[model samples]
Target: MLRTGEQYRDSIRDGRRVWINGERVQDITKHPMFKPMIDVRARIYDMAHDDATRDVMSYEENGERFSVGLKLPYTKDDWHAKRRATDTVLEDIGGVVTRVGDETAGEMWSLYDGQDILNEVDPRFSTNIRNHIHHVIKTDPFHVSANTDPKGDRSKRPQDQDPDMLLHVVKETDAGIIVRGAKYETAAAYANQAFTKPTIANWGNEAMSDYAVGFVCDFSSPNLRFIARTGFAGRAPARDYPLSNKFDEVETLVVYDNVLIPWENVLFYQHTKAATFIRATLHRYSAFAFVQRNLKLADMLIGAALWNVRQTGLEHQPAVQEKLATLACYREGINAHLTAAIADAEESPGGLLMPNQSLLMTGRVLACSQLHHMMHIARELCGGQICITPDVASFEDPEAGPWLDKFYTLNENWASEDRRKLLAYARDLLNSDYAGHRLTFQLFAQSPPFAHLAAVYRNFDWNEALRFTHKSAGLSDQVWGDKR
Candidate 1:
């Protein structure tokens, strides 16, 4: 059943221990650092019921309504609906938000795809993943992901180093497994639950280890401490840092101190094979939503750059147009990949339709790799005034206001207020501290550059290229023989 915004807000206020900026947060939903994002997330939940967006964001099935974003994708139409739903959220919120339920829900779907591997380990474990997937659809919880751990001591195994460095199953009981460690998760403080799993670890000779565990953790579970990073919101005026103040999804280093995972919530446990399988394909389905955020970000870059150029009549210049075109190319490159990925959707082993992995993974690389250059081009186009422009306070001052207005105003068509607002937006988007953090987030959020290329390698059809080259060079048929 669909949930209302208030229901979501009330769900996270379950007395979960949380700290941000070195102070204990009493109510995360009401905390200043978290309130803005929580409101956005709650708004997304409420959007399903809103008359204007109800049809677009939700669907009626069997006398019940379910979120379009959380629905299991089985066909091309499902993907398009999911995309439209995400686009609608970004438009409604006026900015990009990555960790909202839709982006992280697919991580569970990726786990669902690995049901066969889970069954190979233990059939019961496979059932756990399937149940969780359906539970998401039926309950429409605010799901999130927890993959990265504060892993320590690269040289030593989890045993040799502090075992708690990586989240591991410390002990077992009739109730469930007791886990202790930490995870770096975004939006965990306000979200309902997370698909908690291990980070990328090289599973050595051991078939079973404590670190090889994955579970769905409830935020209300005790012994879990959410230590969040300092947020970008409320640090300055929202008008000055528009996106940062409104859309910063506060990340938390969630510390699990013997947190109990009920038997039903455990998806996989004490099995390196299950952990390794999940590690390989964790983002198989989620990467589409993650990369889709880049598309919106690109639009923001283009809008900022184009507006700056148009304001000054610099858009007519040949060099300026070329720079704008470079931004456009980057935007369209992402758009083309997303468009074609859905057009050529492939079937997963688990009977779900997965995006064209090659295209999605490659598009992630292209969009992330070239983002800095695109930002720089946008920065160059916006010019130095973005940095040197006085704040709103200076423009509003009685004595200084006239002098500012006289120079800042281009004409009656463009007033000082409009120009200042645009420049402020451009500054925040291109040159602010928040801008740099966003760039870094995109780079490492899905993993480093090498891992992205690895996904591309794993999914790419290497044989096709090899086949074409082999025929072009007139290679002998025995080149690919079973034996040398």
Candidate 2:
């Protein structure tokens, strides 16, 4: 059964211990800072009922097709449906706001939540996965997010940092284990419905092995505390601000003070060998998902920019047309890589369908870099009108209205007020103190561009690359002169 938008609202209406600026939020569903974000999430729920999205957003449960994400076909056709659904959701979100703790994030985690036990206990990890699938089919779990604690300095190993800085299994019991410490940048944790598997440990020290543990838990689990960050878009006044009026993008510092995890939610507990495998496998899937999400965002931005261009009568301008083309190219490039990844997807040993690691990583790398470059192009194309646009307040003044109308006339065809609205929306996106600088920040922060590039280069099979290069140059695969 799919959860309806109203059902989603009901789920978060009460029993949530969410705090924004030291005040307990009784109803995130109605809170000004959270309502728009929640509304966008509800729209995702509405997707399941959408005529165009039903095929991908909802799956009929046949006895044979046990899992949702994996029960689907491993084909480009399937990828298209998923992309459509993702695009539908992202398009509804005009701000940085997200229900990261919502259904999508939970569904991703449940994909691997009971993974290790599947081979021996449940045999498919399908029970909970299906429940989650149905849940998302309705409301999308309301909120979900992941955390990967690098711990201290990047140059140091996890063991080198204060052990508590990373979440780890401190004690194991017959029923469960206790975990302590914290993970930085657990985005959307404050509002997400579920917590994802923590980071896998990669260190030389034996004491740090507990840090490799993985588990799923509710957001309000005992001993959990949220340290909130300042507003990005959701903090602005309702009437005038462009993006903030419609969205709230929030992040938090999640502190775990001896949290307990039931054995049922524990996916991999200090099985370091398997932990490494799960980590790498999840990394591949995350990259694939990011490619799809970021591409949709880029494509959406392109449409918005081009729409403003046409509305402002700048479409005929040579320079404006050139900038739009570049934006379009970035969109197409991301699509190409995403398609290539889907085309090359493989089935993991655990029976989960996953994409090509190298392709997805390369796409993520390109996404961050391209997104930054694209936003720069948008800023340049829009000119100072984006930054210096008059406050929406001036429109209320009778005397100023005529002056604004005369001086800001793009053309006599469209009314000045209408044009002002579009400009305000554009400025909301391109010029706001939060929206402008933060778009680049999210893109860069998704994965460090430089580290991603290094990983791609390191993972590249140079011999295979050279072989392809030679083949492309019309030489045989053996052009390297090593027949062996």
| Top TM-score prediction, candidate number | 1
Per-candidate Cα RMSD to the true structure, in Å, reads 1.2, 4.6
lDDT on C-alpha atoms for all candidate structures = 0.91, 0.61
TM-score of each: 0.98, 0.81
Q: lDDT tens digits, residues 1-484, model 1?
A: 9999999998988999999998999988888889999999999999999999999999989999999999989999999999999999999999999999898889888888888778877787889888988899999899999988998987777789898999999899998999999999989989899999988558878898888889999988889999999999999888877878988888899999999999889999988988888878888889999999999999999998888889899999999999999999999999999999999999998899999999999999998999999999999999999999998888989999999999999977889989999999988888887888889989989888988998999999888888899899999989979733
- Model 2 scores worst on lDDT over the 10 consecutive residues at 63-72
What lDDT is reached at residue 397 by model 2? 78
Displacement of residue 456 (Cα, Å) in model 2 is 2.8
> How much is 126 displaced in model 2, in angstroms?
11
